[model samples]
Target: MIQMKCRVLLFVKKNMPCVKMMKLSPSPDLNPLDYAIWSILMEKACQKPHPNVESLKRALKKAWKGITLVDLVKIVDNFPKRFQACIDANGGHFE
Candidate 1:
């Protein structure tokens, strides 16, 4: 993720010593977790009512648990193609 904002960038620099800072365009569309996992989780969670914090946590946990390795492999396997598309687009929407 591109950490452009000052406060967040400072926080990362202060706390995450091992992390390297790099410049890259924001490409949320090409993020596998955003495109795959979150949409699935949102669909599943929104299908039911989460009336409280516990319920919301429960729903999110269930949704997270439901992501199979097979599904993850499928998503990750598309990364190279997606990254290439992102590069080809010069950081435009690559989804």
Candidate 2:
């Protein structure tokens, strides 16, 4: 079952680039969740240790709430530019 799913995923991954609408690479540079959101969330949530799993969840939730609409909009606004940079680099590393 897993193998079938993997094969289907691989087929999609191979064809997605030909579509030229989205980049399917798992590079951190290509993913805002990695390049931006996680770091922001981590920094905000990990200022101190949590006493337990519930505490950690609460801290993460509060940190997420603290992220402002303007900040999110700015991050989203930069997304296209980042995609262009990735394309300009031919999927290689870029600043």
Best by lDDT: 2
Stretches of candidate 1 above 4 Å error? 1-26
The TM-score obtained by model 1 is: 0.62
* Candidates' C-alpha lDDT: 0.67, 0.73
How many clashing residue pairs are found in candidate 1?
0
- Model 2 is weakest, by summed lDDT over 10 consecutive residues, at 1-10
55-80 per-residue lDDT for model 2 (tens digits): 98998888877876555656656767
- Look at candidate 1 and tell me the lDDT of residue 72: 65
Candidate 1 differs from the real structure by a C-alpha RMSD in angstroms, to one decimal, of 8.9
The TM-score values for the models, in the order shown, are 0.62, 0.63
